[model samples]
Target: MNIGGRALLNGIMFQSENYTVKARYDKEGNIFITEEQTPTILDNKFVSFMSSLPFLRGIVALFRILWSVRKIFIISFILVIPFTLLLQNYKVINDSNINELTIGVQYLYIVLIIIIFWGINRKYGKFHGAEHKVINTFKRYGKVELASAIKTTRISSRCGTNLVFIVVVLKLISLISGVNSPLVNLSIWLVAYEIFELQETKLAFLSKPFITIGEFLQKLLTTSEPTVYELKPAVEGINHLIKLERTNN
Candidate 1:
């Protein structure tokens, strides 16, 4: 599949009944992407149904967006109570326990990374029309609009989720370390969480540099250019009234 910028697995392009796959690589690593080729059975059915009711389709689209964010909501609910308690019981450990503390922090870091990946991918997938625009713009422009496309299509993100992930990680570390004094641990966690949030914001500000580099690498590896397919005309006389108006006007 075409991954970040390298070929993957047998180093061949392949297509399945429903999807086309390609691979690519960069200095850091490789990535394989499976892109859907055809509308699914569900997509066909939904389009047919929505065609009969345009207003209802809008409602469905909104609901689908909410459904996509359900995971983030669930995680918040699961951790809120524990996080509060962890803050209440926070304590500072001595140098002797620093190693264990570091380990706990590391584990939390891993979990936060996983959470960020999951959240971003999940939200990114739901940008149906936006994804098409991104692919098309990238193909036509020759690597000029990748970051703008990504930012335009990313509708749900607002910097809050990143902060939330960092806060959750701090709470998780406190829970893992089993530190004495709930209040002390809680205080430490809150302080660290705030600092992490600041760091994330600073990192976010620097995102454009990374996007530019990635787009350059991506263009190097990409072989397929987005093509516009013509739609077949419906049976003649199907829209005779519209045709008449066009002729007269």
Candidate 2:
């Protein structure tokens, strides 16, 4: 079973093919677990068809993941528009250079996301580390115990951080080459996703630079070494997800 998860403000969320589980600590330091059915667009015939394609499947999978967090994107969009208008009014962005404006806003959006994650990391980094550790333990040893998880590294090659790095690198290349179009954007994502997948194969060496950058970002900005307190909730979340997957099978 492939397990994936994200770190929450005070805990972690783990999801399998059938279940999404969240284990969090309240203000009183009490841990609580919640379960929900996984919501996925891949259930649709059209989406499933698209997911069967190669390059297209990467975009489809991306959309499915993004759809799960649509609310956050909506909120970010709302915030971005006003700030963009503010920049325009201040002459920070010239409307005549649409490409420049678009790229500027894209950078701003990336910055906004990073800032938000930085804030989350202030209190949640340990949980983030625990989340990666637990997943690593499960994948490597088929176990999710705290001892095994603690022994695993927090850095994960399958992390969204690597994808982010690839996107940023491609964007940088586009900017340098003065090529910014819808087609280029689409190609960037497709290529990035392909590179992401390549990291797991024999040609993984080719993606080592991007993966290294992602690991550096994870260590510097995203995750902190977790203690038993943080690992416990992460372990519980994944174990619950494993149990659900087993029962369903």
Candidate 3:
């Protein structure tokens, strides 16, 4: 899977890809995405409940996206900082205590495991090279593309770096809280951040241009063609182009 970095950093766009999903663009500047999967949390019941009251659900979703940045101190405080503080108050050691591996073999094994996991994630996960290529492609277009703007893109300007910063802050909060269990504090933050992740994805899709284009094109094609007998000459030209497209195909 590829996730966009540019959207997170510059607030220009958000891009992502999954092997199970696909996106494509058609003529007339439309983009289409396949394998869309909406989480159950965003079901009709939740949306309807929120819609029953004005601004409540909208406000909640908006705040969730902001919290994903992890830089929003208020969100961090509500979700993460308190746990960190609790850890600090309990004298939790956030740093790994396994540094005392006097055996060179044991230390080497730990290092190897870290390297292996890093390699695996880099090769297959959201931070892979494919995402970078997609982001670069999107940047090249002025929010437009010829073939399919929905090229698999995983580049994210916001999620990774901001999430790391959030984790670091949470760790510090745990230290400040005097919590003896840094791992526990980290776990709490991770769970809270997962909620933020889902919300961010929804917002990203809504703001995505390629997706918008695809949807618009789908609607356009589905609608009936208006009578154009008066413009037969233009129609002939369009037919020629369409024939060319078919021939090329």
Candidate 4:
């Protein structure tokens, strides 16, 4: 069976061909990267309760995204300092803030995000590469071996890097159009995902421009070619899950 994995804080996570492993990490570094042998009411009931309060649940979800990025203190600093500068420069110095579209805030945000990513990528891109290689090799083959997995390219169509870009685009569009709504956000994500899937399959030439943007995001901000040692965590994660599945059976 194929093995697939994703990178997470302090480690990477993998799944055997039979199951799903989500990237949901909690405080204390606990994660939903593995499946329990049995389900519980707490899981079902809590999900139902959370679903009933969409807005509150959405806030919690936003916290989860923020918490994931809290590791990058420098990025956080870059984000805050620039916004403050934008406010200062674009301000009336009296009563109101800039209410219209301007390159100052939006461009600064994109630039800062890229700058932070450039630094992070150089240091940790190898692990990111390994995560992709392992998953790609497993999805095409059936297992992961360090020697073989190392041969795969780090680029992935379903990368979180692409998702990051999607969310950024969605937010910017929502801001500019003044159409901020959960339903709109969901629709944008779904549409973006479908476009990406099309590029992977039938609409290759038509989606080249969009795919190029994502590729740049991956190349500059998301990944680098991995070394064998960098692949260890991914290999181990895949093997660990496979071992559990064998025992469970």
Candidate 5:
């Protein structure tokens, strides 16, 4: 799924639960590709399993990020009290009151989670940025170039950060009816998938907030500027994928 692994460095391996591959360049101009299968979601909590493995770095562990665990929990920290408060505040959902204490807890939780995510970014952000550029370039032209990739934005409509932002928005809507539940989060993802998959169509304007949040997170937490060498691998890797896909078809 990480087509951008083409831009990554040689030592790192890209692995998500679905598929894993390592792309490397040799002195003879050959592209050597290696792959592995990750464990099932049933094996462990998705994010915990992803984070538990020291073998994965960069975008490989992206989907398994702390914010990407179980659906709505992506903003689990920020909405912890908010969720409970939202459900408890209304008569139908429950019988309780929303107070200043709940609001304060939400802000405190936000700061705490931001610190955690920012710390993770400090380690793998360069590759994260490279991944985004390669993905954008490949999506736009069906190929990737180091130069064009370097000029591309680190933000993408398909970014996990954007998905998280959208989830937060949807969760807010659920508060009106006091349906604070994970099942709502699951349904949100189904709709979100269409939004992301069809983002270039009318979904583009509808998904603007996701793109905006993605850009902000790219700047603040998920990505760092990439170097020429980093960009080179991505270009090569993506070109390899293009060639391989052509051959397979």
Candidate 6:
């Protein structure tokens, strides 16, 4: 069974084809686990049809992920607006340099997002590391126990961080080339997803540059070496997911 997951503020979430599980720690230091049916937009015929196509499938997948985290995107947008208005007041963002301003705003928005995740939500990187390690352990050894997962790498080739890196590079290229249209941005995501998937194929060597930068970024900012205590929820969530998948099979 293929598995994907995300790190939560105080824990981890793992999703399989049919089930989603979240294992978290409460303020009282107790561990709690919750399971639910996995949600998908593929139930809609139109979305399912699009997901069967090539480049469009990548776009659909991207949309699904973004929708799952819509609240974070909404909050980030709201926070950036005030900063944008403040920049406008200072005449730092003017019509004559709108493209450059857009690029600057995008960078600032990323900074704000990192600050939000790292500052307000403490231990986020540790949980993120734990999530990756558990997934890696499952893929490598078909095990999700803490002992096995704790020894695995925290960086995954399939990570969204790599996609983010590709998108950022594409966006910069578009801006520099004076082509900042919405369609261009969508195409960038399509191409980025293609490259992201290529990393798992025989042509993976071609993506070494992107992978190198992504791994560096993951190590530097996105993930921290988590303690065994921090890894508990991730292991529990993935183990539960594996059991659910096996039962269904």
Strongest candidate by lDDT: 2
TM-score of model 5 vs. true structure? 0.57
Top-TM-score candidate index: 2
Candidates in descending TM-score order: 2, 6, 4, 5, 3, 1
C-alpha lDDT score of every prediction, in listed order? 0.38, 0.85, 0.37, 0.63, 0.58, 0.82
lDDT of 5: 0.58
lDDT of 2 by residue, 89-174 (tens): 98877767867778776778678778976876787789989999999999988878988888899998888888888988898788
lDDT of 6 by residue, 92-136 (tens): 888998777777666686677557645522458888889899999
- Candidate structures ordered by lDDT, highest first: 2, 6, 4, 5, 1, 3
- Candidate 5 per-residue C-alpha lDDT over 154-204 given as tens digits, one digit per residue, 9 for 90 to 100: 766666666666555565565545554455655665555545444657658
**Candidate 4: residue 4 Cα off by (Å):** 5.9
lDDT tens digits, residues 83-180, model 3?
A: 75776577563455322322333336445644654554433332222333344444555232322223433333333433433444445554446553
On lDDT, who's better, 3 or 5?
Answer: 5
TM-scores, one per candidate: 0.24, 0.87, 0.30, 0.60, 0.57, 0.84
Error of 4 at 74 (Å): 18
Better of 3 and 5 by TM-score: 5
State the local distance difference test value for candidate 2.
0.85
**Candidate with better TM-score, 1 vs 5:** 5
Tens digit of per-residue lDDT, candidate 1, span 1-249: 111111122222222223333322234544333333433632367655863453444444334334435798789888977864674467454567656765666567667665654554343323222333343333445332434444332221212233344445556666566653556544654453344323336565444433343343222222222211100011111122223333444
TM-score of 3: 0.30
For candidate 4, report its TM-score: 0.60
Distance (Å) between predicted and true CA of 171, model 6?
1.0
